[model samples]
Target: MTLKTAQNIAKQFTLVKAAATTLLALALSATVMMQAASGASRVKDIADFEGIRENILVGYGLVVGLNGTGDSLNNSPFTEQSLEAMLERLGVNTRDTDLKTDNVAAVVVTATLPAFARQGTKVDVTISSIGDAESLLGGTLVVTPLMAADGEVYAVAQGSITVAGFAAGGEAASITKGVPTAGRIANGAIVERELGFDLATLTSLRISLRNPDLTTSRRIAKAINDFIGNRVAKSTDPSTVVLNLDGSKRDDMVDLLTDIEQLMVEPDQIARVVIDEQSGIIVIGKDVKVDTVAIAQGNLTVRITETPQVSQPSPFAEQGQTVVVPRTDIQVTEDGDKKLTVLNSGVRLQELVDGLNALGIGPRDMISILQAIKAAGALQAEIELM
Candidate 1:
């Protein structure tokens, strides 16, 4: 072949290779976009159905069969009264009798009655010592009636107390872990009445978002409507999404809710920075942005050390006496080597973190710097101190 024809063929092959590479790159980009879009959360995870919640039930009771770690009768008069009343209920009259018992403790029992709980359902209960009891370990809670806010008994709790903590001590000191005064029993309370709500009779349902955001609520409503092929879901507020079951295509609310909850929708969140000062924890959201700002943080450190030297008399010295001489050493340091880190305008969360990290700033100092940036109106996100 001629050298010119060979050169032309080589050029054509090179062009073809470049075109194939471009196509592969475009395909990879599209795949990444699709994966990112599919990474959204389901509707059930970010929101809760309105009327479906647990009710708090509380009761006062006595925990017996403790190992001499119960309430002192002298200090806890309520314990004495409760003991007498309990004895009377058991057909043993102990009125006006000197009752000295170190095995009984007055306690408060608490449990949560779950939503749609039937009469036979059993729920977990927590028992806490109200008197000055040393521990509730190895104790059995007496029969107690758990009541709701309206002062109506809904369930009865009586079981062995399972304390997660214990205390052991001598006359000198004591050591304790967890909370010996509190305990939990799995399935200790039996539900006696139902919460007076029927989910099947509801014509409409309200979905309350755990995190209130207008964009998220609207997105959820849109996703529900699109999945059902009807405009039955509407965002009434930032935190509420109302579903019009009457206008929905499906007549069964259960099936409709199941379908709606399984629908995946990308939830939006506000740009927020959370700072926990006590624990030195700072969390910056992915959407957090920062305007153009320069931040410089430095610390002044001063250290003082003390040393004492004893000056003793020599063997031949007649008038010299022993004495202690105090010596102190102090050192001061200033971090003047740190330079100002200038964050550019519209910098995202990663860039902001990188800029801060470049200054060798720790979490505690970064919290103060973020607050300062917020005060200066340079941080384009809300700072929530927790």
Candidate 2:
């Protein structure tokens, strides 16, 4: 059915009513597999293409052009030194005189040169102040050499910085938003060299798991071995699966990788419930199965409140006499008693949500409930908290 039809039906009939009288009873619903219900996923969704990756490059540079919000003269010596050297390069006489600069800041620029990027390619660069600078708005970066991890200059960065924010006023009173000292310039750097890789010489391929699982690794190895009709894949660990296409022709190996990647294998992750206490987030993996157990969750909240009051002197006692006082109060409340919920044998996903909802606990409360269950050996799943 189309989404519009489903929405109309959902609007007319509540999910609970439909579940009891119509939804699950429909034969069509049995054939449809929903991703949310089961964590069954595609191979391509979790594995990366073997030889594809990005290269990181960094460079040191200077940002100029600020009315007075730039680095302070006495604090940032690098700013003063850079300004003097720049003047000398232009044939302008720069002497032993002390320099005071409030329009420049020393910064480190960085960018990720993507795989297969050609020469003269314009890539974005991020500039972060290595020195004290109030803001980088309207600053222009001088040409600076961008180096890779090997210490080779692969690109040169030079552009007018486009700061998306600003800072104003003096030390006493200032209004600022965004990162004043750091900013990004789009298409700011030009790539001068290219990275090379030997694709033809590749004999073995690797399948790296996004989230490692012993069961999933075994399944991946079995799937590849089945497709290639030989023992072509081996699991180095839970995360790495190596595919050795030895004795196979180069053309045949290319075809082999294409078929192996498309082979569908059910990835198995350990049953787990993840919680983010700060955001009150709950994630339940498909394999999460709870043992038959009973649970009750409750919460108590205590709040303190303060109200200020003013006391004035009685008539003619002391005309200007006054005192400050506060009226303090406290409130305590215990939430409603939660009835014990029993987990049936082989409980399903819907049963889990329904059982939790019966307790009338919010996401934050549910986190504590799951934690208690895990501690009691009732929850047969890993409990992760952030």
TM-score of 2: 0.76
Q: What is candidate 1's lDDT per residue for 3-109, written digit by digit as tens?
A: 99999999999999999999999997896677467667878989999888999999999999999999999999999999999989999999989989999999999
RMSD of each: 9.2, 11.5
Q: Which candidate ranks first by TM-score, i.e. highest?
A: 1
Please report, in order, the local distance difference test score of every candidate based on alpha carbons.
0.92, 0.81
- TM-score between model 1 and native: 0.88
Q: How many clashes does the backbone of model 1 have?
A: 0
How much is 113 displaced in model 1, in angstroms?
Answer: 1.0
What TM-score would each prediction reach against the true structure?
A: 0.88, 0.76
Lowest summed lDDT across 10 adjacent residues in model 1 is found at 31-40
